[model samples]
Each structure stands twice: as structure tokens, then as C-alpha cells.
Target chain A: MNTTIRILRYGDYDAMQKAGSNIPATNSSNHATSTAPEWPLWEVFVRSKQGLDHKHVGSLHAADAAMAIENARDVYTRRQEGVSIWVVESKYIHASNPDEADSFYEPASDKVYRHPTFYDLPEAIKHM
Target chain B: MSYQPTVSQLIHLADNALILGHRLSEWCGHGPALEQDIALSNIALDYVGAARNWYQLAANQINSLQDKAAFPLNAQGEATEDTLAYLRDAFDFKNFLLLELPNGDWAVTTLRLLLSASYQQLLLQQLSTNEHADVAAIAAKSLKEVTYHVRWSEDWVKRLGDGTDESHQRLQAAYHELWPYIGEFWENKLALPIDIASMQAQWLAKINQVFEASHLPQGVLPTWHQTGGTEGIHTEHLGYILAEMQFLQRAYPNAEW
Candidate 1:
């Protein structure tokens, strides 16, 4: 299956909430009149100063990507762990079906040539 | 001549952070959302952390003062952070009245943070350049935390003010409820080392921008402003806050973690 990534923006919240098809309304009440609609779930990725890749940290709820980044900072990087943050709507994330694992991954099981064990390197290659 | 911060001045700063931090801690498990709960708690921790720094400096100042009779020192033991925070009576607390009032609702809490954080951001910016190394260092560190706080609170205020009719009304009411106490931020009744009144124009300009963005009403400002928190006079609410906060230590003295 092919996965296409779509960037979510702040203005998209109103449209998503208006559609109200699958998104659940939050039961929490902070406003005086009625319960507020639940914020969209966002998956947070944080890049540490020491590392080059943005690693998956955790998920949080926020109204928009801007708020998601701030929430991620407060929740995930409270100890100064991250130098950069990226937040994507959790709904946009695609995962392979667990039931199809045998069909999807079993083909690679017999491919022994993928391993580099056949290569004979000089003994001087210490780091490798 | 370089300006030296007095013990009262440091205590004033400590009291503001400690009271606001305590108020924010009230929403620890009770925030509207789990993420926001953690966010507010993080902010509370930052305020408490800043308060500890100020109180530590204040303690040192109090201990080293040549004339102990000048300022009213209320701690039973050495003027440690714990003693300054827990041992002081309600009358000794110098936090603004806006901080001690109960966090009414999400709107109230958000607006309060926005207002107070705006003033604190300016105050800390000035103090960060102070001649005193400790004061400057603490203010510089706290300014970073407070800059984020102001941003977070400003975002909420705009969201709530422009959100729904219910949200707009609630935020407007919160503004009205919190308006009078805003003036005390400018009043340096305790004669602190920093010039707070000079920052009033900047604070207003910053808040007015938020107000404009949020579509909150700008007219009908309060004529009479509430003051006296700097002089250690506070509303009845501060007493209750002290009673609850001071309970553990008052019940068992010399207790340590």
C-alpha cells in the first residue's frame, strides 16, 4: 500500500469539526455554556540537539499544528530534550494491517543476499 | 551608582511567582484537557522555579543586612525559600490581588495568565540587565520561561475570545472580572529596585494588540484600580490560600523532604 502524507494546517480544524463525521466531541467542560469539541490528535516528532533524525516522541491533543508544537514542547521536551518539533494529525498516519503481516513481510524472509555477511573486510576496519 | 535590590524587593518578586504558581497548581488534576493540564502544570513549575531563585536571593539579603530593624523579617529560622514561602503570614505576602483570586474558569485562568505574564515578561526583560548578577541571571532564565507563557496564554485568550458565543462571553466576563487588579502591576508601592510604572505603557500596548486580535472590548476601562498587594495588604482570599498552603509545615515544624 502506498502512503501519501498531507500537511494539516490551523484553518483545517473548523472544516474538520464541522464535518463531525468520525471525530468525537470531548466530554470535558471548561466553557460556561457547553462542552467544547475535542481537539484533533497529533503525533509529535522531536529532534534532539545531539541526533540528526526527528524521533517519534508521543501523541497529544491540540486545536492546530501551532498549538500541537507548543503542547509537544511542554509535554515531551520539558527537560530540554528537543531542538526541533514536528506535529502531524494522528489520523494522517498510516500503518500496515496486522492481519496482513504474513503476506506483506514473509517474502523477505528467504532473501539472504540482503545481509552483508558475505563481504570479507580487512581487519583494520575497526569501527565497522 | 549601581542599584542594589532590597530584601523586600526580592520578596515582592518571590511572592508574585509563588502565589501565581500555587494558583496554577490548583488546576493540576483538574484542567479541562490532559495535555493542557500538563501544560499549565509545566508553567506552574516554571513560576515556582523562578520563585525559588528570588527567595534564595531575598534570604541572603535578609541575613546579610547590616540593619535588621529596617525591614520586617518574619521567618522563625534562617530566611530560606521554604520559610519565606511557608512560614510567612498572609500579611507578609506581597503578591498582586489578581493572582490570589480563585481561578474561576478556563477563561479566567487563561486571561489571568495572559495579563500577568505580559507584565512579567516586560519586568523580567528589564531585570535581566540588572547590575546584580544573581538578579540578572534569574531574570534572564525566568524571562525565557515567561516568554513562552505569554505566548501560550495569548493563544488561549484569542481562541476563547473569538471561538463561540459562549466562549466569547465567558472571556469577556473574565476580562471584566480581572480588569481592576491589572493596575496594581504598575504600582510599585513597595519601592522595588525596578521601575514597574515605566513599563505600564508597554504592557498596555502588548495587551491591546491581543485585545484587538481577539475582538475583545477596549472601551469602558475601570476608573478605580485596586492596589496594596505590594504593601502586604491583600484580599480575604490570600488568607485561605495561606491556610491551605502552610498547613503541612505549620503542623510539623522543621520537617524535610
Candidate 2:
């Protein structure tokens, strides 16, 4: 199955300032001298229970991975929604270029045989 | 020797948790970051929950004592947990001086939490195995939460102490400011299960390890350490805290959600 992921990119500091987004930069040192020291963004994923795959829940900012994990626990798991948390630096996530979307994903859409629905199962194959 | 916590000792324990939890709750909306805001609030909830448990136990003990003594009832004689918490004045509270101080900055707040949680973890660990069943049970339940609090604060201590020049300086300043209050945790004659002196040593050693890892200097015993919160002598901050915290209960007696 093809899953479409939306990547929300925060604009650069200058652009953000021009856009009137009052978000402060994350770097504490820069905070003294500059108005834009936002901490790096991290994408948060949570596993609701044991044996479940981690699903992307939301995003947050932190100084490091350890901080990010703790932050994710605080923000996402407060209501006991997650048994485990995974946080990745947003910059580290690789994605197929949006400009190549047609060439990259269109071919898969035409390959009907690639899907399980295309196959006819025997009546005796109960599990299948 | 088998140790049984007296009513006063139980009240002291409950008061410390209640006051510190109130201080932490002040950070609910004002944290440096959104995630930290939630984290601090969660910690505040844990502390208040622990306080409620301790207060409930204390109230039970108080009520039983009143029953045995046939004590005359005062105008506000109920010994419920809410009465103990909301009706008590600042002079009646027994939290550590360290916990009552304002949240100065992120560095100050983080370091204060680190120091207090370290002591609480050790104290609770000892209490979890106490001879008193109720004390042991409450300590055991709170130990898990305190353990996480220590871990969370310890990481921030290390991160800030070693992160940047400004961070290091800010953390060092916070240490200097907060170090004097650490003595209040050890000084006192509570006929409790654990030996506080030995616990203080362990607390120092753990603090030293974190300081070494973070490249911050170990705190020296100050010439004059602040004291007396455990004895119901508090800094001026406690009154304000009580005023804010008890406002609802004070305004509407027996008000319930």
C-alpha cells in the first residue's frame, strides 16, 4: 500500500520573521542576542501497546535525541496513549522528491497484479 | 528497632510533597518549551498524587488518635486530607526550603529538581522497606515516580552544565544559589525509619557523580546553610504559595468539584 506523508517545513528564520510567526529559536545562547534560535525539529512516533508498530503521532523540538524522547513521552504519552516512543530528527528523514512524484508513484498504481486482491484464493486455503 | 511514624512525622512528609508539587505546578504554562511545560506538569501531578496518599494516611492516623483521646472538637476539627492541606497556614507547612524557592530560570528549576529528586529517591528507597506498613507502601508507590523525576532532572543537569558557555554559567550560578538550601533536607529530628545523615552522604555522592559527568563543580558545604522549613519556619514564599493554592477551599468551605 502506498502511504502519503505530509512534511511540514518551517520556514527559514528570515521568512518566519517576515511572516510574523513569533516562534523563538531553540538555541539558548542565540536567544540572548538573536530572536530566532529555534531548536531543531523532531518527528515523534508512538507505539500504543506491545507488539504494535510505532505510528507517527506528532512533532516537537529538542536539543538532542534524549531530550526529544523525553519530550515525546511528556507530550504524547501523558494520557497513557503509548507504551513506547520513538523520536527522529526531522532532517534525518529521507523522502522521495515531490517533483518526481508522478514518475515514482504512478508506475506502482498501474501494477494491479502487485496487490493481493488481484489473486484468487482457493476455497480450502482458509488462512490465505 | 521497629519504627512507627508519628502524626507529626507523617504530616511533615505530606506537607513536603504538597508544597513541592504546588511549586512545580507553577511551571505548567511557563516552561521554556511546550514539551517541557507538559513534562513539568506531569511531574507536578505525580508529586501532588504522592502528597494526597501521604495526607490520607496522616488524616487516618489523626482521626484515630482523636477517637482514642476523646479530644474536644475545634471549630474546624475535621482531620480529612483536604482540611490538612487547605486549612493549614504557611507556619504549619514542613517542606524543604529548596522546594519553596521561586522558579528562577530553566537552569535553576532543573537543578533544584535534580537536587530535590535525588534526595527524595534515596529517602523513598529507604522508606519503601520501612517497618511501618503504611509508610512502606506509600514510599514504594512514590518511588517509581521519584525515580523518573531523578532521571529527567539529571539529564537536564548534564545537558545544561555541558551544553554551552552561557548554560554552564547559568547552571553554576543556580548551584551556588540553591546549595545552601540542601542542608535543610538533612537537619531535623524526625523519629523516622531511615537515618537521614547516611542518606545525606549517599545524596552527595550521587550529586557528585552527576556534577562530574556534567563538568560542573561539586557543591561545597556552605558556611551558613538555610534551615527550618521542616520545623514550620518557611521563607516568605510559602505564604504566597498557600494563598494561591488554598484560595478555592478558603473561599468556599467544603467546596467540591
Candidate 3:
């Protein structure tokens, strides 16, 4: 589901949009890439309620993760919202190889009996 | 000793929370920085919220069960002397020495905020984990607020305690005037008329940490202000404070905005 991603950019949006296909170079940073670098990246999470795990909420520009969580809480959870939270610097995360996605999990598709739905009995338990 | 809280026992808790909240709210418009102003006022509001919660808690715990809402005077239109007698009973509240003392200066107010928030934070944490469900819920919610309050006040206290010569002198003076009241915050439950006795030893360590970091000689521990704030007794200041706080509520019965 692709929604419109609107952002107020610093430089000439037309030049950036006309010249490139994906995100403009400046969205990644403010200054000329050759000059001083961008602000640190941060990852945000929201714990909807008690006993639930922290789900990846989103990310936005932040100088640090501590400030990021505070900003996220203000921006994301301004309403009476989640009870707990956790945040980490985006750059600190190591990614799993996307090339390995099919190789890693595709083998499990053949094991249909592994699913509990095959032998469902009680009407109360049908949803399982 | 077995737990037993008299009528005044509960009133003491309610009173302390009430007066301190009043004193803190006075700082709403006046603060060192805009950021701090926002932060302090938020803390002030939290105190008021805590005070109201404690008052209601006390009201619930009070032994009198006969027509609590039945009293028409509480809403409006009171008796001449008869109403005054009833008002006397309610106002006869006791609170901590730290809360009752004059908010002497920014230094003193900040100091009081720092120390009081620390102790309150500790107490709230203990209560949040306590066996009593009501106390625990109130404490859990209030603790987060007090933690931030303590953080905000701690920054100010440290800055003042170690800053300019004038600032240091004023800060010390604030402490000296207010130190006597510190005992009230840490007093054992004996005549405290409140159940804070469990925390005397605990709070002392936290206070000592703040003192040690401030690195100032305790010239002389101010003689404790042994009186004021218990047994329905109060300083000259409380009546004025209550008049201001309760004025709108008293005037407008059943009014909600």
C-alpha cells in the first residue's frame, strides 16, 4: 500500500526529482554530500499495551536515539497511547541478507502437517 | 507496631500534598528557562494531581461513613459558626516540614523540590509495589511524574549549589532556613500523623547523597521546627493558601469545565 510521501525539502525539488528515480540525495542529508554529514539515524518502536512486544513503529531524523524516542513519543503517541517503548540507533542494526530470504525459509513450505489447522476438531477451537 | 491511622493521620497526608502543590504551582509562570518552565509547571500540575488523589484517598479511608455526599455545605451555602466548626475539622491537616516551610528563594524552592521529589519518588516506587492495590495504582502513576520532577530539580540544585559565590551563599541560606523542615519529611510515624515512618532511614541516605555531592560544610544543622503542620494546626500561611485554592471550587458548586 503506497501512500503519498510528502516532505518539505530544502533545495530545488524539481531538479532532484527530474535527475533521479528513487529518493533524492538530499533526503538522506541536508548539506552537499561532499560537506559535513547528516544527523544520526534512529529506529522507533511502539508497545501498544502491557505484555505485548515492541513493534517497529517507524523512523525519523534525530541527533540521537534518546532524543529520538522522546521525539517519537511526542510525534507518534501524542494521544493517550502506549505504556512502554524501546528505541535504538538505526545505524547500529545489522541487516539479514535479503538474497537469502527465499533460501532461508522456503524449505518450510513443504511441511503442511506442521500446521495445527489440519486436525481442528472443536467448534470453539476452529479459529486456531 | 500495628497500623492505625487516626482521622488526623489521613488529614496530615492530604494537607502536606495540598500545601506543597500550592507552593510549587506558584512557580508556574516564573522559571529559569522556557524549557524548564514547561517542565516545572508539568511537575507542579503532577503535584496538584497527586494531592487531589491523596485527599480523595484519605477521604475514602476516613472512618465516617454517614452521608459523605449528604453534606450540602460541601457544595455551597454553609452555616455561620456551625459551618466554621466543620471547616475547622477539614482544614486541621498536618504535612511534612519540608512542604510547610516558606518557599524562601529560588535556591530554597529548588532545593526543596529536589529533596522532596527524591523522597516522594522513593515512596511512590515502594507504594507502586505495595500490597495495597489503591496505594500501588496511585504510586505507579505518580512515580513517573515525580521521577521527572526529581530530574528537573536535581539539575537546578546542582547548578545553584556549585555555581557563583552569591548563588552558593543564597542556596546555603535556603537550605539553612529549610533544613529544620527536612526532619518532617523523614520523621518516623510517631506523631507525624502519617504513615511515612517506614521511610525515615531510607530517605536519609538519599538526602546524604545530595549533601555529599554539594560539598558544603554543614555549618550547623538548623534546630528542627518541631511544631506546625499536624493535629489540625497550621502556620499563618495555610489559611491564605486554602482560601485561594478553594475559592473557585467553594463558590461554584457542582461546576465543571
Name the candidate that leads on DockQ: 2
lDDT of 2 by residue, B1-257 (tens): 77768777888888888888899999887777778889999999998999999988877777778372332222467577787888888887878888999988878898999999998999999999988898999999999999989999999899889887888898999998899898877776565667888898889899999999889877665668998887888999999999999999889877768
Q: Rate the local accuracy (lDDT) of all candidates.
A: 0.86, 0.84, 0.62
Query: Against the hidden reference, what TM-scores do the models get?
Result: 0.85, 0.83, 0.58
True contacts kept of 1: 0.62
Worst 10 residues of 2 chain A by lDDT: A28-37
Determine the iRMS, in angstroms, of model 1.
Answer: 3.3
For all the models shown, what interface RMSD does each have? 3.3, 4.0, 11.0
Q: After superposition on all CA atoms, what RMSD does each candidate show versus the true structure?
A: 9.3, 8.3, 11.9
Q: What TM-score does candidate 2 get on C-alpha atoms?
A: 0.83
Docking class of 2: acceptable
| Residue B187, model 1: Cα distance from true site in angstroms | 1.6
lDDT of 3: 0.62
Reference contacts reproduced by model 2: 0.67
Deviation of model 2 at B26, angstroms = 1.0
Q: Which tens-of-lDDT digit does each residue in B1-257 have in candidate 3?
A: 54444435445555556678778777666644333344556667677777667666555544254544432234344322122222443335567656766666678888888877877877777667766566678779989887876766665666667766866887788877766666555554535323465575566666666666665554332455555455445666676766776666567744578
User: How much is B24 displaced in model 2, in angstroms?
Assistant: 1.3
- Candidate 2 residue-wise lDDT at B210: 94
Off by over 4 Å in 2: A1-37, A97-128, B67-77
Ranking by DockQ: 2, 1, 3
Q: lDDT of model 1 at residue B77?
A: 37
Individual DockQ of the candidates? 0.33, 0.35, 0.03
